[model samples]
Target chain A: MTQPIIRLEDISKIYGSGNTEVRALLDVNLVVEPGEYCAIMGPSGSGKSTAMNVIGCLDRPTSGRYYLDGVDVAGLSDTELAHVRNRKIGFVFQQFHLLPQLTAMENVMLPMVYAGISYNERRQRAEEALTRVGLANRLSNKPTQLSGGQQQRVAIARAIVNRPVMLLADEPTGALDSQTTQEVMAIFAELNTSGITVVMVTHEPDVARLTRRIVWFRDGQVVHSHLAPSELSQTAVFS
Target chain B: MDMLESVKMAVKTLTANKMRSTLTMLGIIIGNASVITMVGVGQGAQRYASEQFESLGPNVLFIIPGSDDARSNSFDLPRNLTLEDAEAIANQVPSVEAVAAQLQTQQNVTYRNRTANTLVLGTTPEFTTVRSFDVERGRFFTDSDVQRNTRVAALGSELAEKLFGTANPIGEQIRIRNVSFQVIAVMQEKGAFLGNNQDDTVIIPLTTMSNRVTGNTSPYGTEVTVISATARDEASVNAAQFQISNLLRLRHKVTTQDDFVVRTQKDALTIVGNVTGALTLMLAAIAGISLFVGGIGIMNIMLVSVRERTQEIGLRKAIGASRQDILVQFIIEATILAAIGGVVGTAIGIGGVTLIGATTPLKAGVSTTAVILAVGVSGTIGLFFGVFPARQAAKLDPIVALRSA
Candidate 1:
């Protein structure tokens, strides 16, 4: 149907050279369509993080073709790639990497700072994003003052502040307790329901079940791909 | 990103660790303060020396016997300058305004019961004009008194008061070297010069001093001590020196090395000025080393900051910051530190100058050039020292940095 939001073909990533070389990824192919919620699940050292990094444009694949929103990003220069990340991909790490010195509102406004938005508009959009994440009254509170779930919410607000094409999250709820994880998952689910595309990597099967589709990786290669039961279709399943 | 925003970010980061930032800036502060203060003091010393030289006279020259080398070597100076030579210079040289022949001897003076050891000066009536002496009461010795060898003397202000207290001593007789002489005039006040008291001496006719008091020791002519001569004006000092030297050479019948030397007030001023100026430059240079150390301190602290903020760098890069952005951010932080230190240090240096002026003879003088140069140098030092650490931060790979963190 429509062009995929992200398309990867024959992707392979090598860590080192000669005897010490480790193949982090091997001939992996994947496609994510618009308004879709996809989860990548694998054990530790299964190349899930490498696949996430590649999808987020934080790292270039050793040999592959990556088309993000219709442009070949694998051949882009460093500056151009940075611009693409700023304009196209939003990142949310498991650590909730918030600058300690900045307040919640300032942290959320950081991405737009590189987007060259006007000061008034940047502040307005940041306030909207914080409010959307249920942090309206906590705008002036620094990251250390916020709880783990609230900090993740702030990180999510920062990720989407630029209105990037897709949100690339790596274990967004990995650091939270069961209740906080549900709270964060609710926010992501709500954001996804509002037509945002989300690509997440998590080993938890329950977390993967919340997404519309799941891709399973083993030994640096994707071994299975299928739609969740609700959206299951025989032609969409891969074995 | 906007420069204003970058500066805001830098300021925020710096304020987060207030004590460390202040300690980092302390080196620059002390370095700038010392440079400014030393230069100010040096300039003040130069001014003081020039004023002292100007106080000697408008355009005066001292014709001392023997060369500078001979005086420093402690060689005995020939008593070659005679009264005839002084008279000849006065009449023969047009550039020579007035000349005073002086013969000085330390002797004890007694006025009734009061006795004080003082210098008895043998001089002519032209002494008042050549030495800038004013006759406050009565008048100086006339030429006729010199011709007749009259036993009359003029009292300096301090000596007049010492011998007579508030009482007038113009007509009183005082015994010098156990010989009685009448005081003809009382001079006005003149303070000390080069640690020697000018108002503590007695002036009398050279003829009386040579013939009656200290008998002529030189067999060649009426021998006198140093001759004090004045040029017609500022422009005539060199001409007067040249003419006087030639006249003395002929009068003494000198061949290879002349037996006399003429020195000008300007010459002495030049020598003193050079010495103080060089000293000031040396002080500034020494203080500059501290500024260099301050620059190194900035580099050291910046390096540590970059290392500590490796994770932050990765976060910023992931948020779409380019290498240039990180570089500019860190560089701006360093520049702000140095600039703030420079300003505060200048203020402290000005305060120090004021304190020095209040506590000492030097006036409160601030060299604007020194202040500007110090600030400029510190800013440049910050930039120069900041490049390495900033580049290190900018060049860090986002994946490696985030993973390390």
Candidate 2:
């Protein structure tokens, strides 16, 4: 097998010290191979989000060996970690955190701006990303002007604009209706099929069923893992 | 972010909240305008005073007897000015162009049945030349009039119009101190000089005024109230003043304190200059307080802006904006507000000064230094007030900020 794209060994995160200490993650050991589509599910405060944050490099694990591709994240400074996040990881949020002041295309072009791409080139790349998400015609529309499903599509366009190594999405469809949720899941599956590794956090089993594999978390540890059928139904499944 | 992008974003944000931005800028605008206008007015006053003094001719000097001694010692003072002393100075001092002695006294003049209070000046034939008096109607006193002590006088133009009405005053007799004197010439009108109305006076020969008017009761050889001297030109005024002072001291035989004071046109200009300079400085200082208040307004608005854009700051940081980028963004916002306000304020200040100058005699002078200072100071206020909010925004943690949104 090819080497895992993401490797976490004995990862743990403690919230405080001594009596007040809360272990958000405990000895979490996992590896995600290249191009894998995986889903993590847990009840509230069960540490699934915490694990996702650690994997995304948004937070540091108290004790761990986390390797993205091959480099250990524990040794990187905050600035270095930010660079890693910008260059390698893309993020999608449940609330669809598109800047209200910016148009859809501008929101998608944010990462490219930070990367110091020339203005014309950035615009070209952002337009291409929006086209991939079927939003080429709505490039000038603001987030408030778009529907819930359309906003999430813009968020996905933003996520894949830089062609990052991993797409880390936390409840990417939590706020969408059943129909919109299916639309968002279809976009995610399409991206995954195109050779992008996608790690998503969700409590909905229907959402999890769209991915190739599901890892369940309870009390800050992964409790069960299962594989879904290669051909799954696209119809809404609430439970 | 690049500077261009930051500036563009700042302008966009400010324009989005138009009313708040305008109100915020109002403070700076008013502060800048007040400072400019007040300073302009002060400068204009100084210029006006200097101009008035310049119109008085720079070579003229006044010698008033008992002026210095009257201030220090009142008992042993001598009124030692005479027509001879005036002649001696004209001959002895090479810088002196002309010297004219004058004896002044208040009297009631009767023309027909009408009577008016008027000043009587006893002077020589050279008084018209030395005092810059123009002949509006008839000629002035001649040498024959002074030598013969003729019972004749020249009426000033306003006094002529007042006492004679439409009738010609030449060859007419007017009663002065109950003595009838023939009006040989109707003198021209001279406007107010140093707050004294020159048109309200009658000029006659000095010998007639001394021997016929009041019996020359003064003990210091035909005592004169003031002696008027004119220098050859503007360049010789200082030398003329010095020479005249020395001549008068010798004539009075003063060993300790001189009996007279010589006031030059330059000395009057200096006094007016000092007063106006101090007034300008005081007005500028008072206006400076408003600028400081304007800076505080900018600070308050910036703080509010920081609070309102907290989530935006967090999002920008998450997307790779450095601390300096955040700081620069906020600072740019403040700078834009202050700079625009400064420009508008300058226009308003110029307008205000122009309006004042048009309606009143007070001049309103525009100074480039005042404009530059107002604009530069407002910009500085932006930087000063912007620092605290920019620092706070820059220090926000991206992780926490992301979590907040």
Candidate 3:
């Protein structure tokens, strides 16, 4: 009877109304247990991205109850949602959005800054996180000075530096080449194996196959869920 | 988020674009510098004027035969004040220590071959005490010389040099309107007062001037141009003025409006002070307008910055930054720009004031209140103007911002 890390009960997101009504997400229900490596698979306009935004605390569901680690966060204010995201969730974008002005270590220290952590401890933890991502030597390098693979590694380090309940990534390898994509995939796998829950959103079947489970979205609802990798081989569009 | 984090982030962001930051702060810099320097110069001008007036003499008063309205309306002052009036004041007014009656007129004089027009000052021996003029060379004329109407004159410093050319002319003769007079003494350098050259004057006995150059002291008495009086002490100046006014009114038998005016040194100082103070206020106000425009400049730049850094804002928002955090960061950045600009401008302003003080007659002083107010005002302008852009940055939609760049 353990609490789920993320629980969405009847979530809906609508844009406009009447003649121009567009339902981005319609009555979607989702549950993610702790330590689960999950992938959300869909085509364009499938509402998977909308679900990711709602789950990441970057957007509010139009209607529904969202429980994050046993807390009813659906009724929370924007500031309260920001606090939850800082303490309980991490995000990695496809473009590896590391601030150009900051070094790898400073980028990793950003989340802790919002958490009200002191400078010394933030430095130590950021160093440990960069080292964990095999970028200990690149701690002082800016994003412009790093390669795509290395930049992805820094973004990953920034993501997990705060020790969140789950890591949410949107097309984490969308901008990487095949080799760097594999490298980034290996890092995600290692993080998930070390007991950090990972939720990824991607349309590539090959990328989706790498995860432990796949939840498929069609239109604005969850159409199916796969519990095993063997079931994901039947998908199309291999990279 | 904590304040230090916001400030640190702002520093990093601003330092990344040093050129843009400096250019953005230029308006504030100019505004603050002009404000400080202009106020200092204005204050210095006031001090210079007062100093000039003080050099006239301690607790001195001038009795002129013109009312305030008449003096302001025209330059043709009535020649109603007399030598007898001055003598009466010296004898009657208890607070008056000494008096000097003058009948000043321009005359062409020849000393050997050197001929020049000179300011012939018909004054008594008490002129030396009332006007604080000293005899730099030879001896001044005595009371016996004035009583006997001796044809003698004392040249001012420059007048003596012009006529004698460094040679001793104590026993030589000079001509005033064809009347010859012996040289007595050369007066000290009194410098220029009210644009009139004191060193270009020739002092002669009042009796001699009337008898030889002017005319006889007949029906209307000896008509003097102006009467200068001094008080016994600094504190008795008002008493001396009041007593002189009453005696003149009684002697003239004035039943209605008094025809003469008694002006003190303090009265002149007050008028000069008010003029300079108003000028300072006007200059400072103009500088204040520039400061306000500087704030507008800051707002413009900050708005552009917010628009340019949309993606960065999106990324920060995605990584757990609240709207308040974003707002605080941008506002702090703007304030830092203004505060730094204020400090640098203040330094430049102080330098400007110092230069003016050293090179000019104006002793420009940098007021502490002005410095503090300038810095504080610039910082506040930054904060005030920063709000709109900061709020625009904070209100950005993360999804849209992320997709734009």
Best by DockQ: 3
**A25, model 1: CA deviation in Å?**
2.6
Give one digit per residue, the lDDT tens place, for model 1 in A52-167.
98888889999989999889999987777778888898889889999999999999999898888889999999999999999999999999999999999999999999998899
What is the TM-score ranking, best to worst? 3, 1, 2
Top candidate by TM-score = 3
Instruction: Give per-residue lDDT, candidate 3, residue A220.
Output: 96
User: For residues A5-90, could you state the per-residue lDDT of candidate 3 as single tens digits?
Assistant: 99999999999899998899999999999999899998899999999999998889899989999999888988888888888898
DockQ ranking, high to low: 3, 1, 2
Runs in model 2 deviating more than 4 A are A1-5, A9-30, A47-66, A69-82, A215-239, B62-95, B98-133, B139-229, B234-236, B240-263, B354-363
Pairs of colliding residues, candidate 3 = none
Model 2 steric clash pairs: B136-B188
Model 2, B47-110: lDDT tens digits are: 8788777776888888877756484667554667777788888899999888888988898888
Every candidate's chain B TM-score: 0.75, 0.73, 0.83
Q: Model 2 reaches what TM-score against the true structure?
A: 0.76
Tens digit of lDDT per residue, candidate 3, span B1-405? 878778889999999999999987898999899889999999988888888889977689989887667788888977778889999999999999999999888899898788989899898889999889999888889878978989999998998899889799898999999999999898999887755789999999998888888874645578788899999999999999999999999988878878898889998799889999999899889988898898899999999999999989998888888999999999999999899888888998899999999998787999787899899999999999999999999999988888786
Candidate 1 wrongly placed segments (more than 4 Å):
A228-239, B55-58, B64-94, B100-128, B133-227, B248-261, B354-359
lDDT of each: 0.87, 0.85, 0.89
Place model 3 in a CAPRI quality band.
medium
| Residue pairs with backbone atoms closer than 3 Å in model 1 (clashes) | none
Q: What is the lDDT, from 0 to 100, of the residue A75 in candidate 3?
A: 89
DockQ of each: 0.58, 0.33, 0.63
